[model samples]
Target: MPDKPRLERQAMCDRLAMEFQNDWIVNLGVGMPTLCSNYIDDSKEIIFHSENGVIGYGPLSQEGHEDQHLVNAGGQNVTQMPGWPLFTMQIHSL
Candidate 1:
């Protein structure tokens, strides 16, 4: 079978990132959704949220720099923004 061409993951992320507005708060799920954080426009101040209690985090971590304790819902390592808070699931009720 012939190999089908496909958009690279980064390209896909870039496309989706364009849809977000500056004041929006986005919650990303596992897999492809996690990649969206990497392509967010720098001029915009969109907040990235993770199901695993991470808010205002940056993109995925670089190779050799993974933080075992800082993972997204997908279990992929993520970078936390300065002053980003980690809350328990119970906090959502308040």
Candidate 2:
């Protein structure tokens, strides 16, 4: 097989974290989009609102630490906000 190039997902996330401002309320879409959340700055007030009701989803988990039961819409297990709420639907999307 021939060698190919690939876009580093973690690098993309780092950029998002660097670029986002404190007041941003960003929604990380499923797949590559969701990786953006990792780039967020901790000092800033950027909130990653997952559709599943999670407010401040934490950093991406490492292998072996993943729990299938607590996965996001992207099917990746994520960290949760301290007082994050859980729900079934998004009323605003309507």
User: Root-mean-square deviation of each candidate, in angstroms?
Assistant: 4.6, 6.0
Best by TM-score: 1
Candidate 2 lDDT over 27-69, as tens digits, reads: 7767776777656565887778767656667666678887565
Best by lDDT: 1
Candidates in order have lDDT scores of 0.86, 0.69
Measured by TM-score, how close is model 1 to the native structure? 0.79
Worst 10 residues of 1 by lDDT: 85-94
Q: Write the per-residue lDDT of candidate 1 for residues 1-94, one digit (tens) a residue.
A: 9998999988888899999998899999988989998886778888988897778888899999988988887888888876788765544554
lDDT, residue 48, candidate 2: 80
Off by over 4 Å in 2: 1-7, 87-94
Badly placed stretches (over 4 Å) of model 1 are 1-5, 88-94
